[model samples]
Every structure is written in structure tokens, then in C-alpha cells.
Target: MPDHAISGWAVVLGQLAYLLSGTFPDGPLAGAALTLWMAVLGCAGATVLGVGVAVLLDQAPAPLARAIRALLAGLRAIPVLMLIFWAYFLLPMLAGVHVGEVQTVVLALALIGAAYTAQVMEAGFAAIGQGQRNAALALGMTPLQALWLVVLPRTLRAMLPSLGNVWVSLAKDTSLAYIVGVVELSTVATQVNGRSVGYAAQVFAAVALLYFFICVWIESVAALLLAATRSRQRRPLWRYVTLTAFRLARTPARPPPTSASRGSSRSRPAPP
Candidate 1:
């Protein structure tokens, strides 16, 4: 029992070192940079595309809206792991273009993330009041101008928290890159465990902590941005108040005296 315990501890320490340092002989950054970069690019691209889709969907007619919703629902039903596998094995065959594991993973993640983001943004767009758009239109603004200046700002402000949630989900989904053998943090931990022989617990613990730190940092940044947006919204309230007061002050003290009133009674008698 003592020997078994000692061997187990040794394995745990070895795996822990590997997990901390990554599987590559050189270091964590050396092996992990490519995967991390891919994930970042995928998330950014997906967010942009998702926003576009949301804007388009918001403008779509009822029939089109129903179609788009159905399509996105189908996409959401597909598992991320299955998507990654399909992309890895079949994309090259279908397109006659080969890609590395990192590329495959990134593509799969981008598709999945975009679907989720689009749904979230659609809800955000729905939450915006129609009165805001009407007010913009009444100001002599075109439809596009109303959407860009008034609708988008309010929608994005409301969507910030949901967007933050999508980002967190994207971060976790990065681990799914392991399916295609992209050496992300999870992949690195898996490799380390394979080598260390039964130290999965320690390796996984370290990986989980790393992911937690990343998510916490992201949440902090999102919170700061939300506060800044709220501050900007409040500033507009004060401006509106100031403008209303100025208009009230500038209102004519009284209507201009009628021109006929300026004529004296003597001039009126001469005319008679």
C-alpha cells in the first residue's frame, strides 16, 4: 500500500508539471499560442457575423424571420463535438482544400458560436422599444439612420450582458478543440495524463483553475464596459433636460403686439 501510494503521488506530480508547462518540450506558450490565437480569431469573427445576422433578422419580414429562426434552431441542435468532427473529416473532402487541426477547430467553433450569438442578439433587438425608432424617424432621419443611431445603441447596451455570457461559453467551447487534436489547454492536459499514467485528477484541476482565471478576468472587463455604457446613457438624460429648459426659457415672453395696435386713435379718426 505504501509503495502504491508513493507511485501514485509521483505520477500526479509529473502530470501536474506537464499540465502547468504544457506537453511541448519547450513550454506552454510555445505549443498553446497557435490554438489560443485560433480560438480568439474564431470568437471575434463569430461575434461580428452574429451581430450582422441579428440586424438582418430584425429587419426581416415574418416569413423570413420564421425561416431564419428555424435554421438557427437546427444549428443549435447539433453538438459542438460532432460539428468539430465533421469539419475535421469532411470539410477537406467537400471543399478540396485541406486544413490543419487548428483551422478545423476554429471553423467549427466559429459556426457554433455564431449561432448562439445571433440568437442572443435577436432577443436584444426585440427588447428595444419601437418609440425610440419612431422618435429618430420624426427627426428627419432615414430608416437606416434610425437603426444605426438609435436602435443599435440601445440594443447593444441591452445585449452587453448576454454578449458577455456568449463569450464565456465560447471560452469553454475552446476546450472542444481537443477533438481535432488542436493542443489547447485541455488537449495539453490530456497528453500529460497519457504520459504520466493515472494523474488525470491533478492535471484536470490545474486546467480548470486556469480556465476559471480567464473567465473571471473576462467578466471583470465586461462589467467595466457595461458601467461605461450606462454612464453614457445617463449623460444623454441630462442633455435632454438641459435642452428642454433652454426651450422653455427661449419661448416668446408674449406674442408680438399687433401692428394695428401701434396706430394711434388720432390716426384712426382721420381715416374715418
Candidate 2:
């Protein structure tokens, strides 16, 4: 690189501290730290809400289950940007409660994340099916016990990757907070680029790199957790899945009773 280019790059790199901290020492968190905080808070709230709602969807009455499913589908259909807009602009007017920009963004992300998480969890539950729950009940477990001990663990393990992906997506969505002027990483980069008009490419590149690093770190942590969970399980996930498929395949389906068989069984049905 030429000396002038190197000098410009060095000047741009020097703004890294500002991009990360963004008035943190003087004020509250504003840059990458704020983004991460939003993502974490959002994901935590989403996971809790999603799990509760998913369980309710599974166990609720058919009418109520359909309503809950419809609500989730509608929430998922809306864009995250629209959610943010609603939370920021309409929430105060409707609810008469004040919400800071950061809080508003986190709330929007949480709601949307919950919708997706619920969907993933619902699929996981369906995949495991009622057989596991029935087996657990047969072993003297109560309904709640069967859910907690037998069903939730397997479902969560199965859905971990999907959940992690949702979280990663949420982390990326934090960039949208910039639209509300929350001063997250992308916003900070924009500000830096505005000041150094000559180094726009470098500024954006750094921002992308920072986001990439955060997401990769999240994925790595998820992978480690998944590996640890697998080690603790009775069998690896793939083996368990393969064995389950074989069991299901080998189980014979009972034929429907013919008229003669039905008539004979009906006539000879009473035990001595």
C-alpha cells in the first residue's frame, strides 16, 4: 500500500476505540457493547417467552392452541423493522408508557425472536411426538414431570442449533436499532465514515468485520455447548435419531379387522 493509503488506514483504525465505546466512559453504552447487550437481553426474553408459549401451544385446548399458533404466525409474518417502528413510535402513544430507544429495540427483537423460537420449538416437539411422553407417563411420571424430565431436554437438544441461529440473527438485527438512532456498531461506523469521507470503505469493512466476529463467536459457543450436551446424553444425537427411525420402521401396523374377524370377536368377546 502507498504511504498516503497507509496513513489514511491508520487514521481510520484509530477510530476503532470510538466505534466500540461510543461515549461509554462519559455516558451509557452506545456502540458494539450496546448492540451485544440488546441481543443478549432480547434472546433471553425470547427464549423464556418462546418456551412457555410453545409448551402452552402443545398442551392447551384445541381452540386455544389454534389461536396461539395463529398469533405466532402473524407475529412472524411482520418484518422486524416494522416491529421496531411500532415499538418506538406507537407503543408510547398506545400504552402511555415511556420506553428508551435501546429498550424499544430490544423489545421488538425479543417479540420477533420469540415468534421464530416458538416455531422451532413447536417443530421439535412434533418431531419427538407423543410416544416419549406416554412412555414417561407409564414410568410413573406426572404430566409436568414427563415434560420437564423426558420431553424438554430432548427437544431443546434437538433445537439448539436452530435456537442458536435465531440468536445470531437477532444479533445481526441489532443493526436495525440504528434506524432509531440507538448508536450501535453500525451507527457508530456511519458516524465515523461521515467524518472521514475518504475512508468510507475502510470504515464499513471494519463494521462488517466486527459483526462477523461477534456472530462467529456466538456460533462457536453454541457448537461447544452442543458437543457438551451430546457427551452427557445416553447416545449421540445422530445415533439416537437413527435408532428411533429403526424402531419406528420395525413397529408393525395393525391391520383393520375384516367383517368375519369383527363378527367373531364381537360374538366371543365376553371373558369367562
Which candidate ranks first by TM-score, i.e. highest? 2
lDDT of 2 by residue, 1-272 (tens): 58767766786779988888788789878778888889889989898899999988877999999999899999999988889988898988999988989999989999999999999999999999999999978866678767866788789889999999999999999999977778999888888988887878777878888898888877887798788777754566665685466557757899988999988988995777
Candidate 1 structure quality by residue, lDDT tens digits, 1-272:
67765676667565554544454566434223444466577777778888887887878988998898888888889998898899888888999888877777777777777888899887876688788889978866677767866787778778888878877777777787777776777777677667766656655666677778767765776788788778854655654675466557757687777767776543666544
Global lDDT of each candidate? 0.73, 0.86
- Model 1 residue pairs with clashes: none
Which sections of candidate 2 miss by over 4 Å?
Answer: 233-272
Q: Which residue pairs of candidate 2 clash? A: none
State every prediction's TM-score relative to the real structure. Answer: 0.74, 0.83
- Assess the local accuracy of residue 257 in candidate 2 as a C-alpha lDDT between 0 and 100: 85
The Cα error of candidate 2 at residue 271, in Å, is 41
What ranges in model 1 sit over 4 Å off? 1-36, 233-272
Score residue 148 of candidate 2 by CA lDDT. 69
Error of 1 at 32 (Å): 5.9
